[model samples]
Target: MITFNRVRSSILKAKDHRRQLLGIHETDVLRASIAEAPHFRALLSEIQAEAERARREPAPELSFTDFHLFAAQGTRIEYEKPYFERRGRLLALALEAWLHPEQKDLDALQNEIWMLCNEYSWALPAHLPYTLEGVASSRVTMPEVVDLFASETAHALAETLYLLEGRLNPWVVHRVREEIERRIFRPMFDTPNTFPWESSTNNWSAVCGGAVGMAALLLVDDRERLAGMTDRVIRAMGSFLEGYEDDGCCAEGVGYWNYGFGYYVYFAEMLYEFTNGKLNLLQGDKIRRIASFPAAVALTAPLYVNFSDCSETYVPNTGLVSRLHRRLGQPVPEMTAVPSLHADHCYRFPHTVRNLLWTDASLLHQPAAEGTFTFPDTAWIIDKHRLAGGLFAFAAKGGHNDEPHNHNDLGHFILHAAGETLLSDLGAGVYTRDYFREGRYTYLHNASEGHSVPLINGLPQAADREHEAAVLKQEVAPDSRLVYSLDLTGAYPKNSGLRSYIRTFEWSGQAEREEAHLRVNDSFTFAEAVNGVEEFFISLQRPILSPGSVTWRGQTGEVKLTYDADTFSAEAEVIESLDHGSHPLTVHRLRLRAGRVPGEASWSFLFTARAL
Candidate 1:
């Protein structure tokens, strides 16, 4: 319902209003305050250190050889490493120059900006489309194929120009504006649907739309033209919100919630400021629910509900969280520490700058409420309690296999005790061309084999919306025990002869001891006698296996699982792989097998976690 006329009418008539959005004109005041701010000292020091390093080192060269590597070799690391490094350097240089504005820093920042403007395309090669002809043959031109980073690059340059207009050389400022108009604005306005992300219900839509809209808000002067562009971005942002149901459960997990929603908030704030708070995009009940998602999913301070393609832990953007808390009066998880400027390899400009502008130290003092929360719309349940020993938590998901950053995992659960996620969700896998293509499920993290779920007749769960788990029961007892059950038959292939598969979980705290216990009962009924059934439980800690019990020792605690030795054989396997960061990762898989089971079979497992 956001139209061009609505957008145009909302804009303030004051010429200098845009410049005052984030107090961009008050650089001297910011620099003075930032130098003295205790919380920002570490951030300022890191930025200064990185700026010094960048001044000495040559900017990472992005050559044709590196650009073509993704197309030819099907690997992303080779090109992306240096590509992101250059941007990281760019971000450092810009921030330092803005804060200090010394002749040396200004010179370095100007050179960095010019070099970025000269690049053929702002988008990464991996993000570019490979048509039927091939990547080499595809006409991936600038402005025509605007991706997330392309739009972000435009926003960065626009902000830089706005921040250092008088100081920067006239030529550099002119070139930056021209490139933004050519690369982002014209393509976005002229040829709609040139990029699929415009209508995508994921991070791409928010990041691309938000970044583009922010740049236009900063730079565009013509209100009518700006309104048209803003309308498109508003609609794209709507689609991104649509991806989440009313429950505000982010299907892609917390990492992407940080990414996609972060951008949405970035643009929303800018729009609100531009319109003098007349148009507030962050006003609705759904947005408040979405804003509270990170706190709801956190197992502890850092560990989160890493259900889909997400890392086990991530440093939240404190500025974004603080702003949300201030605006919506929603509870955000307390951030023990702020992320370093170099935390993001991509070196996003908005996140870095806003961290300086919006982060409130007082917000960290508000304590978050702890208890059980269930999202029936998404089939996600989470329970956490602070026992005498430590924090104990459990999270389970029963949504369809086809989700944002989809993993073929249903009826998967995670158990946390003390500070460790004993039974862990093997978060995200490495990214290669094939990692997203047909070979996606071959990666352990994306496959059901990597999750804590049962295999029916030696077959893993199928991938699609149709192949989904059905929640049969969810209830809480007066004694604070939680009981949840799911029908997981639809998760398997029809050929697997899975007539019915029920998984029920019962979690309760021990009355006499500072410990927690979880009992999982799995009942299976096949159309015929099944060949075998194997239950796979994944953990980061090495597991010790006995005849009937398996134990995983953590840094501060241990989780021991007990099953019937007569019915199931237990064994453990060490898996070596790469994590989402492409770092070497090791996981232990505890497999409990029931051989040659009858048409109907049932198994139970009791897991006990105690502080060491």
Candidate 2:
């Protein structure tokens, strides 16, 4: 059995010896390294630019109007925009102060840190327990709860104190430690389970546990207390790992794989350092497979298989990927672009710091991954073909509706050709109270209506754990074709009259001929004649409907979807919606309407993509 006994022993031995992890603790040496490294020049410029921006802007006040909006109304972005901006500013200003040691930067950093220290709760209102709204409304009195961001705030503050201790005013430094201890350490240690996330199997477990554990390592000096706390954290980390099956697929999709797994890696690095390399969490076959998920899911340089709540655009953290590559000898996708300073509005401290510490130039030069990757445990198949035309990638899923960040989209697929996603997954809807509550499926992105699947009796797929898709058959040819079939009958309710619904996808590609075709065949059986059936396919580009087919043209290529005109009629509808970023955009939904059909019927549509 794998255990952290060695970690506990190592921590017991290092009784007052505070260790620096992941980066140099001394400011002067760290600054010198940053100044001398050529690759770090761009990062330095970003920090400097953010410093200027921070200097120009006054910190936005976390006001009553904004803070109460989540409770008063169901909206979140009104408060979150300024809330994250404050954190981002603090991160940039602090890093700038540390690097340059300028008096002005230091002064601004002190003020930002002070402002953060004074906040009522480091946890966002959205993360608070629903019953605690009254306390949040007061904006002052509340029990300490270590949500994802609150724990992260504790780590950020503790690390700041660790790195810039002597430079900062004694009062500011003292207050920083006091706040973290009172807010994070005391609550977690005093009451073992301050939040239910300790046992959660999603990103919450990793983010909250990892952040608090890392903060404890950075702040707590008592050996016995640290060991007890660290043991609990290790258990939580284990729970996080249990969330993934043997195949190591993240059902929450790529964006979350970067997030939840990213934190696990960060905490692992710290633990490895704390134990003087005695406890290596990055070892083992399971972790190596988990580390390879991003490369396996990459459809293009900028896109990934965006199932569940993942964003269509996924930017791998270069530093984290490089660290994994160097540690485990795993392959990483070629990442040419660096994340901008504000790319992450939250300004995650560990991610930003590691982006400077762990990046390796050689790792960034690897070729993009190609060919088929399958995860039967999670029921995901991704195939990328490097054709003469460009690149043709097809991804599909057969998981249940009640996944983490669940969407009722079993048997949903994405088709990417050349540089465009002809048939797309809507990715994430804008996060709000209603978006996560009873009205969740009413949103376009969460409902099956927005996916490339068929509805039963004019009803969308249900959102229950039992509403799942079972893999009926799967095939991967050497280089020419891939086939996947799913039994989607359970995805709909009995009242919908659905007896059995089988979805099969045949993806065939010929690189030499620059042609790729995806055949989506759905066979349905009903106990009685259904009201009607509608097949919906989502795309970023508007579809042009012709006699018997619909064509979506992209800049470099186009996808022509041919269906039986005699059985179905096609039309295009535009939905004013939000992307993963919550940016307003128009989504083109192609609907194939079918009249009342017999108890047994089948629909097949062939999607052809070739060089334009």
TM-score of each prediction: 0.96, 0.95
Best by lDDT: 1
Total clashing pairs for each candidate: 0, 0
lDDT (10s digit) by residue, model 2, range 184-213: 887778664446788889998899888898
Per-candidate RMSD, Å: 1.8, 2.4
Q: How close is candidate 1 to the true structure, as a TM-score?
A: 0.96
Question: Whole-model lDDT, candidate 1?
Answer: 0.85
Which ranges in model 1 have alpha carbons more than 4 Å from their true place? 12-15, 23-28, 102-105, 131-143, 192-194, 365-368
lDDT of 1 by residue, 268-316 (tens): 9998888877768897889999999988887666778799999888778
